[model samples]
Target: MEHLFGVMLVWLLAAVWIFLLVSWAITGDVSAVEAAFGSVVALLLAIASAQRAFPYVVPFSLATLGGGAVALPVLRAYLNRAAHAQMDAELIERACLAYEFDPKNYGALINLAEVCYKNGLLEQAVRHLEHAIQQAPVMAANEKRRLRMWQDELQHHPKLGYTPCMHCGARSSVGAVRCERCRHLLLPLLVHGRWVPRQLVHKAVAVWGIAVGASALSLLWREQLTGLNALVAILATLSVALGLIVWVVRR
Candidate 1:
């Protein structure tokens, strides 16, 4: 409901901006300064409304802008993958919530575990898998075997911080800085408290590349571009860049 209201408000502000712009363009009576001011105010209002209505879009767009010097296709593929991951997470969460209404739904628990594993929530995934395994006796023999196999694999998965020692190939305990078998220093895997994935930082670099490239092209063809066209390009680029920053912080 709130999202719908925000979208409607944005459209209203956008319509007003268009009317003011058109009126100024056609009427010689309206001062350029006054028209520009009104346009700026309307644009800001519209952007605010958009943020409220489509919060994720803004951040994703901005992160794309920040992806400086990255190839367009690569950056796009990364974002697409991340978006899919997020969608899967949401779906799994919804399924888990639904399963809560019926605690006997072992399938939902397994699905939730798989999704959590893919999303790097290793500990949570392990817990879900264990729960599903406990409920496995009621399931078929093959199903029990499959669940056990998954649980075994997850128990040794490196992302859970139980990585193999470089020197002796023995697995180290979680948060272990050294290999217990060989006394070798293990590689540190630090998981920071980040709202957004580190991948967003890489995407932001590509975005910066696009912004710079566009600006350079505009400057090179300045004689072919009008003042309004140049202004629009600048504003569009800035908006995208800003949106990526918003996504990074909010995510």
Candidate 2:
């Protein structure tokens, strides 16, 4: 209900913006600044509302925003089609067939996951998600996080006879003795019917500690780091530190 309301509000704002722009262009009554400001606000509102409606459509970035703007006419024409694509069984089956033919296609895997999940095919959904995650090494962190969250949610639906890798969290077939990503030994499910790798847990704790410490230091010394040069230096140092830590953890 709230999403519907937001979409309606966005359309209303967009309509007003278009009316104002057209009126200004025709009569030359409204100031340029006013038109520009109104247009910007309307665009922002529309993007926000569209995100609520279609979270997986685009990443939130300036480049994506510009691309979305350029594609706005097409998007508006087929908005309903794009939004409800997953609900079409025929389309989903076609996507699944395509994925089977080319298992490495990350986009097809993700689409299959979504459609399967929506259709209550929990096991298939989980499998597709895991495959997508494994193949998407270069995917953005935010996108990977979203996929992980979805996989985690589906894990609780029912037993799929698969165990998650303790090191990289990828699901492994049951009775497997090693994780595919990190080659870490999978212990017997002696506790809680699941194996929890202590090394992985310790590494996670160390990473969290470093992140918290860095954030605390940044907050405490924010006033002193006033100049652009200082900001750049800090960012560079932190980036290097983070890169090293990630390399070590992945190794």
Candidate 3:
């Protein structure tokens, strides 16, 4: 029975890491380091204790850890781009620097186009937008139309640069109140390193409240954890790693 419990503990650890593996899919969460640490340690522990069938655990761990590693750099870059593209006076200079660094950079082209349009430089805006379209041929029709609308608008009108949705990282048009790709509010609050949805954060708080209350009641009704049972519980929680990950990502 203790052996069975040990196996269960390994499986529980596996579950914790599995969810954090595709961290790129939830880039909006902005908890890459936390996800990476949570996943890597749990995965290593699981692999050390795994039974038959997960022969590919080692390579798979690499994929999960590497995906998380990829996220951290991407997040840093996105934040840098956001700072440069927003209402800063050096928008043109920064965009040009990014373009020179990567001539085919889609974000750079889009930023240049918006800057040109805002300054009433129609031909330049069209040129940049055309270049941007080339970089992303699968651009939506509405998005294409949205970018070109600068042609009909007043000169020197503020055609601010595009920004990736804080939640989904999909590009959003200037002045849009919501992200077209994810339908999340465009303006999200920056908590810690992530721009999390206010509603989701509120929900997380309520979830914690309910969870704590339930745990407290259960503890009151039961004997205090000790010995082998306590050991199982600690292992099941990944030695507090899983709990910390949830808190950092949500809080």
Q: Which candidate is the best by TM-score?
A: 1
User: Candidate 2's C-alpha lDDT?
Assistant: 0.54
**What lDDT tens digits, residue by residue, belong to model 3 across residues 61-158?**
34444443454456446555554434333666567567767878888778877765654445556667777778887964654896667555534555
Best by lDDT: 2
True-vs-predicted CA distance for residue 84, candidate 1, Å? 0.9
List, in order, the clash count of every candidate structure: 17, 0, 0
CA lDDT, candidate 1, residue 192: 19
Count: clashes, candidate 3 = 0
Task: Sort the candidates on TM-score, descending order.
Answer: 1, 2, 3
TM-score, candidate number 2: 0.29
Worst-scoring 10-residue span by lDDT in model 2: 186-195
Compute the lDDT of residue 101 as modeled in candidate 3: 79
Residue 97, candidate 1: how far off, in angstroms? 0.9
Error of 1 at 108 (Å): 1.5
Residue range 1-251, candidate 1, lDDT tens digits = 75556456455645655464457446633346544644554454456446542234333323332231134335445556655766775667565565666665788777766765666656556666666667766664765675566668767775545645556778876434356888754331111121345355554543444454344334433434568886776567567656765664466
